[model samples]
Target: MDSNGVDEQEMKLVQGAAGYVLEDVPHLSDYILDLPTYPNPLQSNPAYSVVRQYFVDEDDTVPQKIVVHKDSPRGTHFRRAGPRQKVYFKPADVRACIVTCGGLCPGLNTVIREIVCGLHYMYGVTEVLGVNCGFSGFYSKNTVTLTPKDVSDIHKRGGTMLGTSRGGHDTSKIVDNIQDREINQVYIIGGDGTQKGASAIYKEIRRRGLKVAVAGIPKTIDNDIPVIDKSFGFDTAVEEAQRAINAAHVEATSVENGIGLVKLMGRYSGFIAMYATLASRDVDCCLIPESPFYLEGKGGLYEFIAKRLRENGHMVIVVAEGAGQDLVAESIEQQDASGNKLLKDVGLWMSLKIKEHFAKQRKMDITLKYIGTFCPLPNFNSSYLRFLKYECDWVHVSDPTYMIRAIPANASDNVYSTLLAQSAVHGAMAGYTGFISGLVNGRHTYIPFNRITEKQNKVVITDRMWARMLSSTNQPSFMNPPNGATEGAN
Candidate 1:
């Protein structure tokens, strides 16, 4: 039986507006799920039931599905399976594989470690393989044998012990490798693109009449995977961003007419910049990809910065990398390895505009310093901003992108990643494939990959969280503000 409690042959795929084309995926039957009644050694203890959910059968009159969000028409249905339940595969015969993909996240190694440990400690599955690089590891013979002891110290380190890469989402070749290794279960650690690849691998496994299980551990530093309350490594990213913001704050306050500009990582969302700005409470301006702001109008960012400088003498600005891409002179159709659109250096562009506007004004005693590797801060001589030139005291710009991403998991992420990894392994052992382990509504549950990647998780400007962030930073709202404030509440 599957999550919907339907027979395997009766299952059919159903497409939704969100683009998930799967429904009623079959779970392993009792015959194939040949295992002992007690897979968990601690199942007999009453205290152990705290972490488990026994089979639930609700009243027939009640609705079985729940509306996910008010903005979406679709809802999520319930699924069965908990800690005490018997796992589908027998431990001794199971040969599992783990693969990490996409960019570096703080909790990659932690997830890998926990999964290896759980498979070994909980199920007695001794044989495990780590696929080096991304899906390409599945294409070639790049694999390493993994044991609990081998990954005992990996959680303390950053990056994956198995290594990772992008753009190797070849499903057929990956399936071929799985068969070659006789892998019965595959755990994938990655973001949306990588999970999409996992989905393809699962479908291919099914098409080949193989009972292999494929599970995903949600991994977007951006925290944009939909339906999950929060993705692992997001809290760590936000925490690390505060250090950069603090550096900018220190630089800005240290000089007489200094402006500190910090750029953060948010491709299509503003959660990182917003949360960092809120947590740091030192930013005069916060910009994100989801919101666009003018550089020089009456209610524009230029006047806002000038006002702040005249009042506070120094100001700090936090901008997400994807913010203000629309303002660039040319369209940026180029994408990165993970299918994300490459954004122009909005922080650099805005800094140049501020320098030009203040210099042209002449009466305003202001200097702008921009520092970052994306564009030359001091030497950026764009033809577009060549009409006016002015000298500013200094613009301190720094990108903590790589530095922040390569660090070990923070305290919060350590717990979250371990739970996600444990849930992923348990799901696979329970014959749940084509799913991503996530914390939905505070519960550790298996979310179908199709549902997980159905939509991009962008910050809702109308949400109270955005409102609180704006309130904390005292920044002008790019979107309409509450209580009937002006168009761009300043």
Candidate 2:
């Protein structure tokens, strides 16, 4: 029952020169027999009275790739996200519930708040419930009613007010809870694994012939979710990451031969590390999961570090958590509640290896300090420890791992969070089931759950962004020609 395979409703593929281009997501009407429709309450709302053409046409779709040649087909296009003139449920009959699963990220509270407010103010629908602790909350009897007053200023906070957890996903129990509670609209928020769970729930609900609308707002601090311009909180993560990079830069430049190493969160893709390093432009070397590098060689990371230090007398290195995992000896592999593979401490491993390389060189004494972060351990120093391990006595560091995600969403992310939440609510109200509220090429659209979960969006090492990062840091490509983008995610 995995959504990894395409269903007939999702076979809206267009044949172009590239061939087999997925163009649209599944609709509830495709599976549910004789679904009812009602006029959208927004048509009578005074808030939209001043607006022209507030409703998006069903035929409207956003292209996945905009920079294509004239002769090329439109390529992939997703159903645009917005309120429809016709909705599936009346305000009185709609009883909606929201659940947040997986890890914490900035703007979670904002999405929750906006969903409550959007349903209340825009559609005149009340009675929103917050599912206590993720998918398990459904059967655990963990529930709380949500109102505009309840989530009044939650947008100014970090993490989720509804609470979240990894794993604990039982499809039957969850859908049964939905059935028992008579919840017609279920809003599930989380990353890829959580989306997969959402997809499963949607399939089960459809199989049971329920009139539920399952809408997902893709949540990942990594920005690894595909079919979207970027995930929510990514801007805030990159912006907040500047603090640590600045700290590392100042620390590295303060003393002679001082090396400041920073470890960032990126389990499968190095988007965070790559974007942070690119924004700072203060890093001497950047390492990520997308581009693998060996420790010792004529043109290896060790030689690059030695040359950079010799040229500048001080340097800062940024490494993603999943970067160089193969290089770490006996790195224990594990999985979390959501089935995400646990990553070894690449920050610690890299720091020690770099120190050892310098030690064996016997050329110059280096003052190196570091920090790292882990996903499960949200405590203050857990992420810092990723940069500096216990094996080295020279570990001095700063931890912004939790600090970044725990802070209130900045202006940019706050706005983005509002759009994503409202879009999900609109889609659910419009009867779009098993779809994710995501951005495709800057336009908001409803993407199929399977389209986003099948593969993670990784950093393309051969692309211009990687080249720009290399140009910014003056770091070597690390590979003779670098590896393909499919060398696994991030």
Candidate 3:
């Protein structure tokens, strides 16, 4: 106390008997303590680690600028919140299970192995079960309990060892089973369809007061899952595509007189084809489902190949399997072995077109090699199994014991899959459910839980602008047109 019954100084420091000092200050510019001296541990919480890592710079400063080119209008609807609510789940109390649904992808085993290992080893979770045949496996008696030892050798295997089914599980029944088994956490690994099922299961479980946490692991060769940057098998699929393209290149180069047409798999999107084209520079042209090519059009694939043969001596064309050649065949009124009008095979048709164009216009001799059997090994069954059943007269086994089992683990997908599995487990332990762990821009990240809202999922592309951008023909618009149209113009 001062003589005037008030502290004279703007800041007052009181010392205690144990050498502890309390500093009291109000609007004192000179004596104000900096934020560095008073750190908030919540700011560094690991749950928001992924978000912070992306938004914060190397110097721990938040970036001032963020550029979002696409979905700007939809993005504007989102309002930034002050801080994320902390939700925690007891690691021991959480009983988790993983189920792989749909067809097998390259990294399914990798993800399965990681989930099993991460739960048991890192989080001290031992009651992790592997549901076989996806949703069906949950209700059926075929549910397999997984241990760390069971998953130890499965990193490199191509398919899910726990098995998968398309869409057989009754959501209510599955919830009942989960409750009966006392499963508190369920990790569903598959595509959008599977996620929809997972969401249903989540709703059912929550409704029943089981307190089960349901999360999804995005697994699809299509790479169409929203919010996630890239799924696990996408890289493997691209790698396989590159290998096929490189092999095709070798064959084309060795023949010296032939053009190789290789077809890739992608139904609605050209992500795989585009990524493969970027990976395998040897691919001369890439045709995707997003891009439709016409035989009569100027700079069409046929004309492009013909020009390539006339100019570069040989060419390799990569076509998406879904890019129907029916348009071209319909234009020409061609029919096939079934007495039904047949669309030309993309590879064979393009090859024939190239040959016919060269032979008619110029007296150039050209050989065509249509390499269409380049199926990736792991996904080959899923890609062609139905065809094999009908075309090859293969009998369907009613109780196919071997087909019901999961794939052996592969070495390539094991590491990343395990890392992702652990990340998901960590997130779950920290009260993050209904979110998937994703690797984006070459870094491990969590797809925000809120981003998977019903509105986001229900959002559809009414306009074809984004779809057109994915097309091969439209992509060239980004580059300045050549002065003379590259000599292939009609």
Each prediction's whole-model lDDT (CA): 0.74, 0.82, 0.54
Q: Which of 1 and 2 is the better model by lDDT?
A: 2
Error of 3 at 116 (Å): 1.4
Best TM-score among the predictions, by candidate number: 2
Using Cα atoms with residue i matched to residue i, what is each candidate's TM-score against the true structure?
0.84, 0.91, 0.65
User: How many steric clashes does model 1 contain?
Assistant: 4
Highest lDDT, which number?
2
| Tens digit per residue, CA lDDT, model 3, 1-490 | 4332122221234444433333221111222223112222334546546664323121111111234546432121111111123324445665788898876677777777777776665455778888877788878856777887888767656576887767585888898898889887888887666766776675555444455566677766756565544666666677667655665676677655567666665544556666777667676677665555555445555556656666667776777655644343333454332122433345434444465566676766665555553222222345344433232211122111112123333355556666677666655554434456665444544453333323221112233533443353222221233344332212
Give a tens-digit lDDT track for model 1, residues 321-410. 888776654543778787777666677667766776677789676655554554433334475334323343343344665556788999
* 85: Cα error in model 3, Å: 13
Instruction: State each candidate's clash count.
Output: 4, 7, 11
How well does model 3 score by local distance difference test? 0.54
Better of 1 and 3 by lDDT: 1
Report the Cα lDDT for residue 350, model 1. 70
Cα displacement (angstroms), candidate 2, residue 167, comes to 0.4
On residues 1-490, what C-alpha lDDT tens digit does candidate 2 reach at each position?
Answer: 3343325544555454553254666667766669889989888898899989999987787878889886776567788899999998888888999999998899999999999999999888888999998999999989999999999999887889988999999999999999999999999999999999998898888778788899999999988998799989989988988888888778788888888888888887999999999889889998989998765666777778888889999999998888877666553467888777877666766666677768878997787767544222222255445543443534344455555676778899999999999999999888888889998888899898888888999999989999999999998887762333212111
- Work out how many backbone clashes candidate 2 has: 7
